[model samples]
Structure formats: C-alpha cells, structure tokens
Target: MMHHLLFCILLFPLSQLVCAREEAFAIVIPSSRLQCYFVPVESANHSKLIFDYQVIYGGISESEENFGLAASESYSSLTVAAETLRERLIRLRKQLDASEHFQSSRRVYETRDRMLMESKLSRVNFWSFINLVAMITVAGLQIYMVKSLFEDHSRVGQLLRRTF
Candidate 1:
C-alpha cells in the first residue's frame, strides 16, 4: 500500500507536467529597436488585434509601372504565418478533445452561456457616447489651459526682463 501510494503521487505531477507541455505555444515578435524578441499573450477573447508589431520582416512589395511609388504589398508571409498558427490551434483542439478535463460537452455549455450573456448585454444601453464626449471636452480644455498659461507666463517673463 505504501509503494502504491508513492507511485500515484509521483505519476500525478508527471502527468500534469506532460499535459502542460503539450499545450504550450510560442510566438516570437522581433523588433529592430528592441534586441530581444517578445511573446505576446492573448489578454481578451474579444480583441483580435496584436499590439506593438510595427516592424515588417517578410513580405513582397509590388511596383507600379505608371507611378514611382509601390502600388501594393503582398501578404504571403503573413498568410503563411496565420496558416501555421491555425494548424497548431487545430492540433491543440484535437488534443483537448481527447483530454478528460476538457471535453466537447463542456465547451458547448460554455459557448451557450457566453452567447446568452452577450445577447442580454446587447439589450442594455451604454454610456460610451457620453463618456467619449466628456473625454474630448476635458482634453480640449486641458490643451487650451496649458497654451494660455504658457503664453501668459512668457509675456510676464518678457515684461519683467524689460523692466529690470
């Protein structure tokens, strides 16, 4: 019984470690200014845009015959990257399907719950418009105040210098 209990305890952590390693994902974002590459994590499900990706590493530029400037840019590299990511995600999905902890039924339940909540939330009114207007007004007032204060201080400094 003692040996059996020890074996179970050892296997539990090993299983967890293996599971964690199986679901691991790595994304490298290279920047010229920053020497080191960064792995960005998804913060929210609603937000699909990746932030701080200013550098364009791999892409083809199309030249315009009539005009001097480039007409368009090809997204072949980006599309290839997206396809690779999708393939990885699909593999992960298949692994998760086989997992005892993560089953299709649970996913369906969660999806239904999320859809229901979103539907209810969509019916409610938001104060976003009012907030946006208030924010713009405050920013405009702040800029005007700063500009006026700077002008007044410079004029006062000029007068004082002239008097001295």
Candidate 2:
C-alpha cells in the first residue's frame, strides 16, 4: 500500500516541468575589459532579443538574454568606454587646475622672475599634456585589445565544448 501511494504521488501533476528549456549566454565587449552574462528561462532560441545587466542588443530567435553576439553590440558598451575616458580626462584636468593655481601665486614676483618661471612652467605643462594624452590613448587601446582577447577565449571555449 505504501509503495502504491508513493507511485501515485510521483505521477501527480508534474506537467509544469515538461516543455521548458534553459540557456546561458556570455559576451565580451570590443575594446574594453568587460563582459556580460545572461540566463534565460525560456529557450534562447525562441527569442529575438536579449538583455543583460548593463547591455541590450540584437539577437537571434534562439538567442537568450545571455552574453551572446547581440548583447555585445548594444549601446551600453559604447557608454562604458566613453565614461571611462571621461573620468580619466576629468582627473587630468584636476591636475592641470592644481598646477595653474600654484603658478598664480608667483604673480607677486618681479616681471623678469615671473616671466622666467612662467616660461618653464608652461613648457613643462605642454609636455605633460602631450604625454598624458598619449598614455591614455595607449591604455585605452590596450584595454580594447584585452577585451577582444576575452571574446576570442570565450569563442574558443564554446567551440571546444561543442566539438568535445
């Protein structure tokens, strides 16, 4: 009797679990050291779009909101890169401001002394600006290259999984 009761309970309305599928997605944005991931409850193959934490983009019907191709192409990626550069620029500007403030105090000195100091300061500032900008540009490019490498790694992983 206990066995029969157990069997009946097991067969009871488990229909809710019958037709669903789960999928995961991951994406590495171009030119930045960032990646996004998503897991869709319904089959990713049935959806036309996907959304991740900070990204949204074109997708295949079977694509879930996972970190797949579409999500990487979203506008969020651009915003991230732009915002990063802006922050760096703001920091550099603050340094420039500090230098300017320091120079302003030298205004009380004689014309000859002030002119000489100003000339030296100006030359240093000009070179500093050039170097800072060049450094930032190179850093940004490196970040982009790293992100691209991440994408390649993920792709290789996927390929390996499928082939194995």
Superposed model 2: Cα runs more than 4 Å off:
1-109, 153-164
Residues 1-164, model 1: lDDT tens digits: 56434433332222111122244333343322222334454555433423222222432223322434343433675678899999999999888768846676788899999999987776543566667889999999788655655575666555655676
Model 2 C-alpha lDDT per residue in residues 57-156, reported as the tens digit of each score: 3222323325554655777888899999999999999999998887876654567797899999999999999999999999997886556555756665
Collision pairs in model 1: none
Instruction: Assess each prediction's global lDDT (C-alpha) against the native.
Output: 0.52, 0.57
Quickly count the clashes in candidate 2: 10
Model 2 global lDDT (CA atoms, 0 to 1): 0.57
Worst 10 residues of 1 by lDDT: 12-21
TM-score of each: 0.20, 0.26
For each of the candidates, give the backbone clash count.
0, 10
